[model samples]
Target: MSALILFDFDGTLADTAPDLAAAANRQRTRKGLEPMAYEALRPVASQGARGLLRVALGLRPGDPDYEPTRLQFLEDYAAGSTVHSKLFPGIEALLSDIRRRGLSWGIVTNKVTYLTLPIVEYLDLTRESAVLVCGDTTAHSKPHPLPLQHAAREAGFSVERCVYVGDDLRDIQAAHAAGMPAVAAAYGYVGEDDNITTWEAETCAHSSTELWSAIEPLLPSDLR
Candidate 1:
């Protein structure tokens, strides 16, 4: 049997924080808000634009300007989508290794379908992904079992045979909630104050190489 691997797109499989931060800055500049550095934005990259806008522009969700700022951020992000987005180092090697081992991998993300499709295409990863689940594909997103369960169903695997790898607390929560094992991606944009050790996961991988190593032991015997 082939073990199913589900990955998060933004911070886990791709280094999209820079481009996201740039978009945030663009919106901030337009709003006369201070431009925040990419480093400062990295930790909140997986939280989506609302969280980022709040962090960068000091706007709360209930604020009257929040929606306008979010819309502006979306426009800015769309304009700069491919400018600085790229896969993390050694990711290609890790994917190749998985292919070589005959394991199937998929992506489950809370990112909107429009942005997710283009980014996957831009990275030349569409052909490589066995399954792709976007935020709006179903009624619920991550932290809800719907997305991961949906991915497993589409990939023809039992949830128990799958492992979901992601960079955020919600990822682990969702995977576990879905009855699947989880892997925490340590190299992702998690903050210094974040408690990775508290996240419930089968294992943690600090880099692409380490991820591959950790995954190797879990590969189905058929592949070995």
Candidate 2:
């Protein structure tokens, strides 16, 4: 089977922080609170509503307002998900190179299907991706091996022939659990306090420009 490269959607494959930050800011505005700075919110974009809400309003899941707020945040985000979202710089060329090398690529993300589908379609990735596995696609999400494992099966690849790239620590953990090499996207929404080196990925790409070099070494020798 062909070698497969799986990427995490938000932060990794796409710069989705602008829209996500806007959604969180909208929540603050409605409550007479000032919007937080984009820089403050950007780092937590990979965490989705949970992280955004916490930073935006000091709210947590068990709080009474958290559930409703989370739902509204998602609704607001879904409406503007693609307004500023786009492939990271050099990502298009990276994908092209992967395709030219006969490697299959797909997305495995914690984003639920409804949210992910629209953005994928907007970005014109719907037809090109060999597989699209979302948070709801499997029994468990990242940090759990099911989603990555499922993507491998759907794309007709063995775990050994797959490499997963993402911007979150959980992504590396999931890849490890699935027996796949992992590449960390350091240029993505990594938290200010996070140390990329501590993620223990096979390699860390500091920017989209560096991704290919970081990934090349992880590929099977035959594929290289």
Candidate 3:
């Protein structure tokens, strides 16, 4: 049977850190603080506004300044979300290969629809993806199985016939909870301290170039 491949949007399918970091840095600049290095900010990109705000301003959710600052940061991000965001090297080819193999693919992300759709369009994946499930698309996000389960159902695949790929530990957790196999994207913005080995993915792809090899083995013989 043909299989379904579901991917996380940020860090997995696209290198979105440059633009995410830029928004965080803009917050710093407005406060007369020098912007943090891109290298430092990139690691927390997957964590979204909460992570970026903490890094850029040392502010956490409950802090008095956190909510307003987060709003501003998100506003800044929405304005230029696609400016520096692009698919990781080899990703377009990888998606094409999946299609040629008669497999279907979709995106399941914690990114909200408003924020996710624009980038998906910018990367020209809007028409090609079999389904698009966002944080708001379900009641819960990653680390919860709802989003992944929703994606599989929307794409007409059983949970066992799908594979989830992402760079975050939560992605693995979600896939496991959904009764699907998972692949860790080691090339993505895995935080500096994260050890991908312990994420318990069925296999780990060190880069987009290695992804096909890692994923193909996890598929049924016919699908492979």
Candidate 2 residue lDDT tens string, 1-224: 46999999999989999999999999999889999999999999999999999999999999999999999999999999989999999998888888988899999999999999999999888777899999999999999999999999999999999999999999999999999999999999998799988999999999989999999899988867
Better of 1 and 2 by TM-score: 2
Residue 56, model 2: Cα distance from true site in angstroms: 0.4
Model 1, residue 78: displacement in angstroms?
1.1
Kindly report which residue pairs in candidate 3 clash with one another.
none
Q: What would the TM-scores of all predictions be?
A: 0.95, 0.98, 0.98
Cα TM-score of candidate 3: 0.98
Residues 1-224 of candidate 1: C-alpha lDDT, one tens digit per residue: 77888899998999999899998888878867778887888999998897798789887788999988888889889888888999998988888777776778999999999888998999999887889999999899999999999999998998977888999999999999999878899999798888998997778998866887766655455654
Clashes of each: 0, 0, 0
Which lDDT value does model 1 have at 200?
72
Superposed on all Cα atoms, the candidates' RMSDs to the truth, in angstroms, are 1.4, 0.8, 0.8
- How much is the lDDT of residue 170 in candidate 3? 97
**C-alpha lDDT of candidate 3 relative to the true structure:** 0.93
Task: Give the runs in model 1 whose Cα sits over 4 Å from its true position.
Answer: 219-224
Task: Give each model's whole-structure lDDT.
Answer: 0.87, 0.94, 0.93
Which residue pairs show backbone clashes in model 2? none
> What is the lDDT ranking, best to worst?
2, 3, 1
lDDT for each residue of candidate 3 in 88-202, tens digit (9 for 90 to 100):
9999999998998899999999999999999999999987799999999999999999999999999999998999999999999999999989999999988879998898999
